[model samples]
Target: MEKIATREAYGRALAALGEEQPALVVLDADLSKSTKTAIFQRKFPERFFNCGVAEQNMMGVAAGLAASGKIPFCSTFAVFATGRAFDQIRQSIAYPRLNVKIAASHAGITVGEDGASHQALEDLALMRALPGMTVLVPADAVETEKAVRAALEVDGPVYLRLGRAPVPVLHGPDFIFRLGEAVCLREGKDATIIATGIMVSQALEAAQMLADEGLDVRVLDMHTIKPLDVAAVVRAALETGAIVTAEEHSIIGGLGSAVAEALGEECPVPMKRVGIKDVFGESGRPEELLEKYGLTPYHLAEAVKEVLARKQAACR
Candidate 1:
């Protein structure tokens, strides 16, 4: 029931990692306060660098630090981190496979009141497109902490997408975080809901709602966007026969697209994608934006029903 922002967890994780990993350095594009990297700056000032609103330059610096054998974590708003500094990220870090961690905060439409310009609806697609780039979208504070540590173990570039709003803590102390693996939150036979980021919690809620109507629904927390757990996706498609993917991003190339791609190649099935319908976000409260963009649990539940109907028709 407790709620905490993923950015807050990321900051705390960075500070924790700094104690154990001396080579770990943090760089921010003058937005540490918003990105929550200020926590690390406060703990280890010498290791933190403020790039002064230059996302591209920060990425370049991160690449340089990485080249020098230092694990550099670049923090900034998701929009600027991916959109403003894309070339630097691609050329400097991802192209050469530098060990730079780009922990982008305030991702997706949850960046309420910032409007479409600040919101990063396409960051996942951009990051996923990069070769050897590990993309992670943690479901909550717990997963964010684990994801930060996991990203450190990875040898190549990593894009850790985080949200601004506080979300329910989904994982417990016993939960283990593995890169490129999907966590099955709940088991069911009728259908499965694959979700990433904040939508994972919503998918669980929708699954519970469907249970009340005697519709069994499985739920998967697809935290890793790239190197997607195709095995789990294929298993879900083969067993459940239907799937509904939900995310706080565009339907084009996010969790939905990843699931669809896997299903198409391996096990084809009836599916529905619940996300922003090729539209931009607006300035409003986080909850309001979610409802307006049809990213709520109700929308996910409706999508489940629609997919279920399609699955039944396929059998007929």
Candidate 2:
């Protein structure tokens, strides 16, 4: 299995899109190297702008470019992109529904040594709250490229979350990326594991571990956080009877919250959320942070068993 960072894929995608879309421009808040937007800058210098550590100003500039009929992509660390420039994003772009792409990198605890200040655990929640803002969290390099192209097609604001660490390539050449649609990775009848971002791979691993124990588990890659495929979530709840949602974010308002909300309104069922437990991330290796925060495949498998037990109890 090959591994590649989502940010690496994003940079390659931007460079590829630049050739076809002349109106596409990129803006970075003095972190092009980390965000990987430097790839685009190298290919098309005239179209790239370095905003010099001003995330708010960069967003305003992106909004202006969009207003001028240019498709602007703002790149920066996820914490600064969503937290430091939140007001500008909300007022300048999302409020007026500007056609801008906020492609933030180094999102979630996977940021590793950057610590809690740099890690963006709530970016998804913030982006999902905005009206008409399409939020995407691609599972791997392959999906990241597909997501970048899909975000271009959307007319309104888009928030594309990316990670710093390399993850397994889950999708193949035939995989089609669709906005606001959940991809069913594996089929099972006992229960379902719904995941987004890097957690998608972990969910698949957990499902396989459960299978060895004779417990059939389905796996869903919910790449889109907003306009969340409620139909698929409802269908999973109705068929599987139990579900476990996993993500490298806070459980309050990420993939877990979204799935729980949909299940509550449509088809209620036994479920467990595996994510950051209302806390901040600490400085450590990516794998270490994941284990410490209970975001690993073992934790997801345990959550599945817990939810399965609850589902059986409900039937009794």
Candidate 3:
């Protein structure tokens, strides 16, 4: 299987979109090469703006460009993009509901070797809290490209959370992506594993491992977190009887919270959330961090059984 980082895919997709959409523009906070926005900058030099490390100024510029009917995609590290310039995003772009796309790279604990200061474990929470902000976390390169195109078509603010590490391709070119919809990767009745971002692949692996042990677990790729697929979440709860939510982000306000909120209101069930447990990340290899943070396939498989046990005990 081929492997590519979501950030690389974002850059390629933005460059492709630039060819189709004349008003499309790219902005980087002096890290275009790392963020992969250099791909677009090289192609559309006139439309690209290097904001020189000022995320606040870059966001304001993006908002201004959006107001002028130009679709601006602001790129930077997720931590800086969400935390450093949050006020600007809320006031300039989100408050006004401008057509600005914030494509943040190196999100989550996968920003290995960069430590907690660089890793953005809480970006989703911050972005989802904003009014009318659309949040997307793609699983792989294919989905990242599809999401980039979808975000470009939307009218208001869109936050795309991208990873720095390369991941295996999970979908083919024919895979269609729709905003606020969850994709069921595998179907089963014992339990359901709902995951987002890089954890989607791990969830799939966990499902396969459980299958070997005669446990049938459903898998769902919940790419969009804000306007969550409530119907799918409800269906998973109603049909599977148990749920395990996973993500590369913190469990506090990410995919787990969104799923729990939906299930709590609509269809209550036994649930287990697999994610960073309200702690900071450390400098290490991406794979090592995943294991240490309990975001691995083994952990997911165990969570599936743990929730299933609870569900069974409840039924008895």
Candidate 4:
């Protein structure tokens, strides 16, 4: 179980993409080191821009570069790039459907010690609301690299959400990635676990634990947020008759809500959300906050059992 930081994978992917595409440019908001864009800067200084602490300016510059036929990747903290520059991204990039990639790092509550202000739990809801913006949340480091390359190939404005925590690489380097698609990690019939970002790894561990308790749990890697895998969600609902969605984002409008919305329309069943419950993060280690916020494997396993009980009791 090798754990790699998603930021590092994004960095390597960007460098490789830049090498292949001359039109690709990287821009950092004085966060080359934090966002891991330094690798690209070291490799192609001419194609990288270190815009000083000005996330808004960096976004505008990226839009301009894209308008001139250059694919620009604007790297910054998720909170600043998505929430702080909402107007710029909405009007300049997404409204006009520019070929700009918003490479947002340190997303979700994984960014510990920096406290609530730096944590970006609401980034998904914000970016998903923008019209014509494709939102992606990779499960692990290897997936992040694949998503970075795939997003560059997309034609419209895209939001690539990466994290700071070191998550286990469940997938191989040869793994294929497609935008707006979800993958079924584990198959079962008792219940289903739909998760995204770092939660996908935990959900897999939880599923194994649930199996030990004689409860079957299926797991889905919902890497894409905007064009959510509605077909997969519907299928899971039809097969299992229940769903438990887990994520590192807010329970209101992130993966949990997305899955619930899809299920509500077609196949409604017992549902529960395992994520941050409308709360702010505090200064602490990543693992501690995850435990406190009920994102651990045991918590998810327990949630699966609870939802299964609900479904069973509903029939009576």
Candidate 5:
């Protein structure tokens, strides 16, 4: 399987969308090369706006463009796109429900040596809190392209969480992406592993490991966090009897929290979340950071075992 960074996919998709949608415009905060929005800028130079390190101003400009009937895709690092322009995003774009797509790149601890300040472990939490905001975390290159296209079709504001590190292309060319829908990657009756973004592929790996131990593990790709697939969460809880959620973000307020919130109300089950345990990330290689932070497949497999154990103990 070929590996491609989600940011690279976003750039290519945006450039393709530009050729189709004349109303589509792009805004970047002086990180076009890193964010990969330079691809779109190169193809559609006239439609690209370089806001020069001012994320707040970029959000405002995107909102203005959206108001003028233009579909604006604001590009920047996830930390700056969400943290630096939170107020602007909430007030300017989300408040009015503008058609602005915040294509945030370099998300999660995968930003690597940039360290905690650059790593966006809480961007999903921030974006998900905004009313009418659509939060999407594509698992790989194929999903990233679909997400970029889907964001354009959606009505309101969209936040696309993209990664700096390359990940295996999990889905095939025929796979269709639907917003607020969870795709079941694997089936099992004993336990369910729900994961979003880069963790989806990791969950698949964990499923294989659990299978070797005679534990049947179901895998779910919960790519959309804001309009979470509550039905899938409830189904996994009721059918599998246990659930384990994995993400590259903090376990406190990310995909894990969203799944817990839905299941807590809909159908409570024995569950454990695999992610950063409420701690900031540090400078390191992406793979090393993932292992140190316990975001690896081994950790997810262990989480599955722990949840299943709790499930059995409760029955006993």
Candidate 6:
């Protein structure tokens, strides 16, 4: 399969949506080309706004546009989109439930050589904490396109986190996407691995490898971080006897925390989480960081094996 970068998918999706929806507007902080909003700027020059290196001001501008009934999508590196302008997003978008979409690029360790300063590893936690905010992290290029189209229909504030690295297409054109809904890619009873963002693909790869060792692993794409698919998570916990939650964000407040919150109240199970540890990242390539932080398919496979072993021991 030909791998395409998630940023490219955002560009094509923005261009398609810009041509179709006149009310849609895009803004960037002098990084339109890097964030992949240049495509939308090219096709819909009047609707696109380049705020020029001012992330905070760009966020404020988006809020103003949203107040005026225009659906604004603010694009920038995820760090600046949420870190620098979090207060604006909180007061302007979430407080009023404004119809604005923050399409953040270069999320997670996928920013590669740009180092930890540009990577947005904490975006999921930040966006999920905002009241009335909808957080969506697409797994790959194909899913990124679907996520962009879906963000428009959501009634309130939505944060669409995207990445820069080229990844394999996990779904075909027929995949249906919806906000707050999780997709079950593979079904199993031995153990269920719930993952979001780029880790979804890694979970799937781990499941395939584990199946060869006689462990039937279930894989779920838990894309919506906020308002997570609790029912699906609970059902998996009840059926699988164990779970492993994974993501590209910090383990404390991302998919792991959400799943633990649901399962702890409902059906508790022997479980573990795979994600970035509670520490700041350093400069490295995406693949190197993933391996260093134990975000690889090998690590996921090993985690599943360990969790299954623990569950069996408890049963005995």
Note the Cα lDDT for every prediction shown: 0.94, 0.95, 0.95, 0.91, 0.93, 0.89
Tens digit per residue, CA lDDT, model 4, 214-288: 888899999998899899999988899889999998998888988888888988999999999999888889999
TM-scores for every predicted model: 0.99, 0.99, 0.99, 0.98, 0.99, 0.98
lDDT of 6 by residue, 153-245 (tens): 888899998888888898999999977889999999999999988888899999999998898999999988888999999999888999999
How well does candidate 1 score on lDDT at residue 254?
A: 88
- Could you give me the TM-score of model 4 versus the true structure? 0.98
lDDT-superior candidate, 2 or 5 = 2
Model 6 — which ten-residue stretch has the worst lDDT?
Answer: 112-121
| Candidate 3 wrong stretches, greater than 4 Å | none
Tens digits of per-residue lDDT, candidate 2, 1-316, equal 9999999999999999999999999999998998899999999999999999889999999999999999999999999999999999999999999999999999999999989999999999999999999999999999999999999989989999999999999999889998999999999999999999999999999999999999999999999999899999999999999999999999999999999999999999999999999999999999999999998989999999999999999999
Model 1, C-alpha of 312: deviation from truth (Å) = 0.6
Per residue, candidate 3 scores C-alpha lDDT tens digits across 1-316 of 7999999999999999999999999999999999999999999999999999899999999999999999999999999999999999999999999999999999998899989899999999999999999999999999999999999999999999999999989999999999999999999999999999899999999999999999999999999997899999999999999999999988999999999999999999999989999999999999999999999999999999999899999989
What stretches of model 2 exceed 4 Å from their correct place?
none
Report the alpha-carbon TM-score of model 1 versus the true structure: 0.99
Regions more than 4 Å wrong, model 5: none
**TM-score, structure 3 vs. true:** 0.99
Q: Scored by Cα lDDT, where does model 5 land? A: 0.93
**Backbone clashes in model 2, listed as residue pairs:** none
In terms of lDDT, the poorest run of 10 residues in model 1 is: 271-280
Cα error, residue 276 of model 5, in Å, equals: 1.1
RMSD of 5: 0.7
Say which prediction, candidate 3 or candidate 4, comes out ahead on lDDT: 3
